[model samples]
Target: DIYAYGSTFRGGEVGVVIVNSGSSAHEISIGGLAVAVKAMGWLVTSNETSSSDPLSARGVMWNGQSSPQSFPLLSLGAYSASLSDDGVLIELPPYSAAGLVVYF
Candidate 1:
């Protein structure tokens, strides 16, 4: 199952949260905007969805990078894409969550 939540902020910025709870991947298209120029976001997920071990369950990655252990914060890799005429297309992996901001 896939769930999506979206909210429009000031200055024509739209924030979205997509959650994929099932074991299959899903591709979603978002449209109906006046004009969408770009989309950027981050994804959080673990290696496995079924693992119950404390370490495995607690381990999470931001945009496919492991958590940092020292200072000099880890650089979050942004997911950027140019919107098509139809809209912005997003792919969600199983048991993952994505936070995105769409700019107009």
Candidate 2:
């Protein structure tokens, strides 16, 4: 289970995802939607066929009949999927992007 006990915000839209690498379902909690750390679950899938696919090459992934993949998979970014206020994003310091994950 993943629990967030701090504050998080974005000057622009932000996407957050939480994955359960364990064999069983995990629990998650955030303080709030705006200030709380956002989280979501990503189902484990088979080997990726495209660079755009979620087939993370970081670790050994189940080929539909194997074990779990390693952390840090190849996923799309939120900015590429969502059209946001250009000014809002452009004005943010580079550190902002470092802190947030742009999920699709």
Candidate 3:
């Protein structure tokens, strides 16, 4: 139901990406990040949260493969849902310590 707009299976470079899990807690990649969300049957914009970072950011997720606690990445498209740490960061995070990053 929720996946990268372009192609979930081959999310190569359609301007959209997925938030899958990884080995470490901080697994997702946040560089050149962007997101799209559909909530309450309504649409959201990634204007404020959307950033064209050349350095690369990261997100933190407790549930990526299982559970419904994947709050950081609520959907996949071009909107933003309270963007968090995606993994692959130069510095460590000070948040909850439970981050599931997806390198896109």
Candidate 4:
């Protein structure tokens, strides 16, 4: 099961998601709602890990993918205008938890 919680402000939104299952990865979509995302942090239950490594998580795409071609995990921040209609896709590892802060 996937659990999510957050709030929206005049400038942006913030929230957290919990991935209960441990088999497949999950993706979240935020489309046509914002212009960019400032940052994100992740904590994997199985890995017992959580980090916001800027070097490794330069940014994220709307398609649930990360930028810099490789930095997509542990951190998130993307400032662009080519987001997909599918929205801002947030990749969630198995049995993990994440927090997101999006900007407009």
Candidate 5:
């Protein structure tokens, strides 16, 4: 299953959250933007089999620190897209979540 939530700021910035809860991956397309901008996302997942264990996220440096081995801030690339006619596409992995932001 896939869940998405989006919000638009007064200044026209866009923030989106996409979550995939199932055991498979999916491709999602988003539209409605005035201009195209760089889109970035982080991959979050859990390593523990127990439900009580907390989840961890990778991609993008944290606290302005450069930990290339830790969080290798990733470009959306194949997982995300910029299309003609102001559209965005995203690929979500199973049991993962992406917090997407786009500037107009």
Candidate 6:
């Protein structure tokens, strides 16, 4: 199962949070925007495909970075979303979460 939540920010930016609970990948598209100029966000997922492995819990990576304490100011990599004809296209991996910001 996949869930998506979205809200508009103060500066006309749209923030979206997506969660995939099932053990399958999905490609989703979001619409109802004026014109999306940019899309960026962070993804959290484990190295293993399934979370059944106890050791996989320690393999969680945020935006491709394994260590969260390594950065002094909590910087997220420039993870981008693709702009589709319908709206914004995002890939949702199994048992993963993503937070995105869409600017118009």
Worst 10 residues of 2 by lDDT: 90-99
Candidate numbers sorted by lDDT from highest down: 1, 6, 5, 4, 2, 3
Clashes of each: 0, 2, 20, 3, 1, 0
Residues 1-104 of candidate 6 have per-residue lDDT tens digits of 89989899999998989998877888877786547787888888776655585235776677777647765525766688656557777788788888889887
Give the per-residue lDDT digits (tens) of candidate 2, residues 1-104: 22222233465434444433323333333222333233222223334333343334342332222344443444432232232333112111111111223322
TM-score of each: 0.80, 0.25, 0.17, 0.46, 0.59, 0.77
TM-score of 6: 0.77
| Better by lDDT, candidate 3 or 1 | 1
Off by over 4 Å in 3: 1-23, 34-80, 83-104
Q: Distance (Å) between predicted and true CA of 9, model 5?
A: 3.0
Q: RMSD for all candidates, in order, please.
A: 2.9, 13.1, 14.9, 9.6, 6.3, 2.8
**lDDT of each structure?**
0.78, 0.30, 0.29, 0.50, 0.60, 0.77
Q: How many steric clashes does model 5 contain?
A: 1
- lDDT by residue (1-104, candidate 3, tens digit) is 12233223354322333322222223234344444221111122222223353113343222222223445545532222343344133212222122222323
Q: Best candidate per TM-score, number?
A: 1
In model 2, which regions exceed 4 Å deviation? 1-11, 34-104
Query: What's the C-alpha lDDT at position 60 in model 5?
Result: 30
Candidate 2: TM-score? 0.25
Clashing pairs in model 6, backbone N/Cα/C closer than 3 A = none
Error (Å) of candidate 1 at residue 20 is: 0.6
